[model samples]
Target: MLREIDVVISTNKDLLGLETLINQIKNQSGKFEVSIIIIHQYRRVENLPKFLVDNKILYKNLAEQNLSNAKNEGIKLSRSKIMTFIDDDVSISQDYFLSSWEFLNRNNCDLMFCRINKMNSNLPLSRNMKDNSKKINYFNSSCCLSSSMWINKKENENLYFDKNIGLGAKFGSGDETDFIFSSLSLKKKIYYNSKVSMYHPEEFIGLDNSKQIYSKFFSYGMGQGALYKKHYNKNKFLCIYLYFLSLIKSVLGIFLYLFFFKLKNVIKYFALFYGKIVGFNNYKNIQ
Candidate 1:
């Protein structure tokens, strides 16, 4: 039987890691048939390994670096009824592929995002809301929704990730959540199942934290601003004002943390708001 679902992996600069990820997929036991498409964003893999070349996986070299661009290409090429986007460095248990299939059926949702588990203890976990409220919740970034999200392709073919945002693009992040937010605006059915999960081990090692923070948060802030401009058009003028106002908000956030004795968040709060300012200024850069 043909595979019922397609897994689109957006990755760059790591063929060995991609090899291991392929192994994990091969090792999975699932009731649903699966096919994969790897969107290599950069650095073409010359002399393909026999394991990957022999498999049913279709490989495409995308010279561009935008994560959203890779995702859009993958979605365009996907031939399954259902599709899920994942990052290359992420790993899932043997049951992950099958579980996502099950989740889509059980929830009967247009889009379903399970959970993303981080590998590091110090890093922090994405918000896990257990309530069954079923209300559309807005996400600050794609932090809560990992690449593990599952979706029905035929039902929402027009709903694609924003090309201007995400990694390798002008905007730092928010492609994942922006898709979710747009779906909500379109009044599409969305479900969140805390039980289903995807694991992404800590990869933020040997990096300069200060520089990383400055650039990443700035882009994220910009993404947020862009999201507002895209979805909340009425708020565009107000967003500009709020962008300037964030300096005050950032200072207040820092003081709030100091009051609560959570001193570490001082920089985090500052980073977040400062990034917002940077994003607000460069909102049109990606849009």
Candidate 2:
């Protein structure tokens, strides 16, 4: 039986980390035949790894399109039983593929995810690991979704990454999470393997009580709100009302922090509230 797999890395020019990840894959043990697909806007480095260029790695350049389109292009080139997606910034643990393969093969899930380990030691544990035993409830295609996953090749025609959702790596987000939700709604299994992990390097030793980290997370939260409004099936009127209420609460939370607490926390909550409002208002524009 052929146990070949194709891994697609969505990258820009993070060669410092990319080289390490490539080596990890090359060194992993399995009867798997591997191929690489890189979707990049521009190659910042002149010389890529010789092994990657000399072997089966295929590079597709779409100078101004969104990442969803790039991901779609990579999937088109993938020729194997299983297709995996990983981010450029991640360093996979040795057992990453082994765990992914076993879970995918055993459970027959097309959309699967693994745990993430934040490189920054100061971040809380919830951001890094999922309780291994709990069943995954929804699809969230961000670092974790792309860090490790398998999609059946034959199913490609039916599943194209929505270019509209993850467009341009901008304020737009949640395409992968939305995709997983779409797949699971069709009754396909989506699995979470807590043991499969990757290391995400952030700027700080851990996200200290920094203004920058809070701002980033606030943008992330707003993106999620946009996603829920776009794809969730709950009552529309209620959803809109609740979204507004939540947005207001986040704003008030910031004010409270301003009055009697950490200044960084206030900025974080303000950014999050702003992002949610912006995201929510922009949905009409996206369509």
Candidate 3:
């Protein structure tokens, strides 16, 4: 059974916890053809695996685009029917391709959603995933998998990713969310499978209240809000009203954090809240 799949990863040169991950894939035990496409901007990491540099892989140096654009580059280089999106900060415990092969093949699924857990901690992960068993209308872009995922090679030649909408030059957020929603609008089916799992190592302690971080999140919220309003619900007034309410609630969370824990996260909390207050576009302009 030759399950040919292309693995796509977008990363900077500063990935810290990927040594074990690279080793695991190099030593994977499976009967599958796997190709790795990496979009990287840095040249500091030394001693990359032979599999990555010598053969069975494509390397593109992107010094201009954001993560979403890097992902698009990977998609363009991929020749396999199925494309797997893996983060740079993660590793696999088993044969990464084999774990998801049976499930994806049996279903002949266009989109096979994988499960992810936190690394080095007991804290539960959060997923805004659908609960029902039927094919979902949309999904968060955090960890999405696809077979024939890109729109088209020629007609949608510019379909790598919407640079204007996703994480732009500054590690822009919401690329995954934007992609998922856009795909759903085209009436694509996205399915969830628990068998495929990966570890997402958490590193950010708390979100900074800086203009950059807050603005980025606000743009993310706005993108999410627009999606919700356009597809799920058409109540524009309600969406606007809820948007303001969300801002208030975020601000309130800051005071609560300070009052209870006596922690100095005011800057972080306030930046996030203010982003919501000014709206996503306003936040983007500051960037």
Candidate 4:
């Protein structure tokens, strides 16, 4: 009766509301065993509340500030066949685990996908992710955030989180997407199970008409640039096409805003397009 799934959550100093999130996971009505682990992203462990230590919850306090690095460490510590990542700012429904476990057991795929509810918004991040039972490799359609990803340990042992690309690293974001793309490139099967889900708080990504949004988009570009550098000559057309297409998409959105005399996101889109072009060239020497 060993646990088959490990839900790895990464958090920093902001640990005020984890009790409710942990309660949600504890209440999941799943047949298979699930171990919820929290990795304190900061170097110091003394600040943690006593309840975490007294409850004997499986937790770790590492000095590493990298998000992917902490997750990779979770893989090393997890004693399960499946590893799923969630953020500190998320909660899950009762059926989240059971559905994911059932889907993985039935399909036996290397990767599993579930629904993501923006605990703050009515419309989902993407509408294509239906409640249908199916398998697909959609590169640009879905993001790794809302739909928390599940990884089969046996199939992805050689894959490690790209440390230089996640939060607190060179690129302030794009770590999860990098991990997903890396898994896909390994020829592994990814299954999308629309039933399972988790709740991400209102500001999961801080995406909006704010100045901070530019930094968010910039981090993505830098990370994407590093990815492009890694596979510059590998996918030639497909890779470059995606880069150009992303740039064009943002640039077009900026124009649409200007036409309407609404200048709220003009700088934001420009920053995104600029980040893509800059990210494409910035990491060429490193990877």
Candidate 5:
């Protein structure tokens, strides 16, 4: 009766998506026993699906609207040896759980970053997708996507996401990167594999709202900035190099987009650059 895996999902008002994801997990074919832990935030509990109420799933609600807080809460409640954190809006491949279980045990992995593709398409959700599996390092830690991560709780018992840098938090989006940085600092065995995959909706695929696009990219940039500051003391040289590297890339993107007359992309890069400056300066206040 031992639980082999705990799938932790933090959501806010995405009831339909939650139901779909949970059902998908239930339908997964595997020899492993998996438990579902849902950390719902920022709303009164609604009448959940009968299956959820009748099943042995663990569901909790929080008053605050913080992604990291919700995920941390899930971590505390999880009782399985392996834990997988996934977004509610995503769906897993047919063999997701079995593949992840096999990969973890076969490699003796402490933490794993899996591939994420756009729903109904072969295109990757994150730009960091790799063609092959390999051990993660400080230089390549950017490949750590939170949407489809698998962690061996027995190996990483103390692992937790940073509360200051995720959706609804001040910095607003580098929780996974910060987690990877901490793991690497601890000499944890982290790896990235394309075999274990999930499918998510493509971001801004058909969206026409300029303000929404700007806000999204800006928030992400702020999180990146705060992450650099948070770990600057641990490795000043790396932090400095990454900060400038990001700044340079953003600048180049702005100019390149401008030349191509892609106004939206120009705005996106500009917002990222500006947000980084603001987040870097505001880090002291938050700390």
Candidate 6:
């Protein structure tokens, strides 16, 4: 008896959010069976919520704290044809599961990236294309956010997130992009759909916490840079184009923000620009 979808959530120290997401998943209205796989990292089993035991939702405790590793563990434990990865802090629409199933089978998609809107706001959490669905390629793969992504394991049995470039890893980002690039390299069918959406909290960038904000953005930039280097051999033109595009954007953002006396924005863009350079140079060293 195979399940229709296995929703894998890699979480740590967010029991409240985890419990809320689980309840939301339970309330999801769909004809298919959906199983939840929780990869709890850096936490003791005793710290987990009691609902997990009472409800008998499958979960595993991992001592390691790598995002990619946690997600890979979920993949290993999953027993479904379709797997969906989402962050614990986010919430999905009521039609998320059914919509994903219908879209995948209707379009014969191997992997699909859905829109991520900010909770209670019309704006999106990240840059997304128009509402229309379209094929995803290496050039516009920035929209392939992992939190709202669904994958067909039967079509991509060998696909796995890169361990060296995620949140807890040295590079600290770009795990999703690396996964998308690998799928494209294998000629997998990938699509982006706005109809299948999830809601995430807005990323806060306050004036009082400029240093922390800069550090976070810099880490993300490093991962982006490493990602470009890692896949340079696979698609030279795409890599070069994206690398220079980021460089140019960061530079422009710095000058633009500086002119308007937006010190926070200036710091963010500068850190990102410098971090990318360091990451590109230090990729081989880290490996």
Best prediction by lDDT: 5
Q: Where is model 4 poorest over a 10-residue stretch in terms of lDDT?
A: 138-147
Arrange candidates by lDDT, descending: 5, 6, 4, 1, 2, 3
Q: State residue 258's C-alpha deviation in candidate 6, in Å.
A: 3.8
lDDT of 6 at 73: 90
Error of 6 at 150 (Å): 0.5
128-182, model 1: which lDDT tens digit per residue? 4342324345532233464777777546346778888777766667677678877
In Å, residue 43's CA in model 6 sits off its true spot by: 3.9
Error of 6 at 201 (Å): 1.1
| Global lDDT scores for all candidate models | 0.68, 0.67, 0.55, 0.69, 0.84, 0.82
lDDT by residue for model 6 over 1-287, one digit each (tens)?
A: 43478889998775656777787787777666778888888557745567676444687888888999999998888888888998988887778888878888788888898888888765678765456788998777777788988888764355778888989888888998888888888888999987777888876623358888788889888998899999888778888899999889899999999999988779888988988887877888866
Q: Model 2 residue 8 lDDT? A: 87
Candidate 4 structure lDDT: 0.69
Better of 1 and 2 by TM-score: 1
Per-residue lDDT over 1-287 for candidate 4, one digit per residue giving the tens place of the 0 to 100 score: 55567878888865665777777776778565767788887757755555455343688888878888888888788777877887777677788777777788788777776767677554454555565656655354343452387887665355777888877777655666666677777877777776666666543255665667777767766776666555657677767767777778788979987888756567657766777777778776556
lDDT of 3 by residue, 236-265 (tens): 464466555656766786888788873444
Candidate 4 Cα deviation (angstroms), residue 87: 0.6
Clashing pairs in 6: none
Model 1, backbone clash pairs (residues 3+ apart or across chains), number? 1
Comparing 1 and 6 by lDDT, which wins? 6
What is the model-wide C-alpha lDDT for candidate 1? 0.68
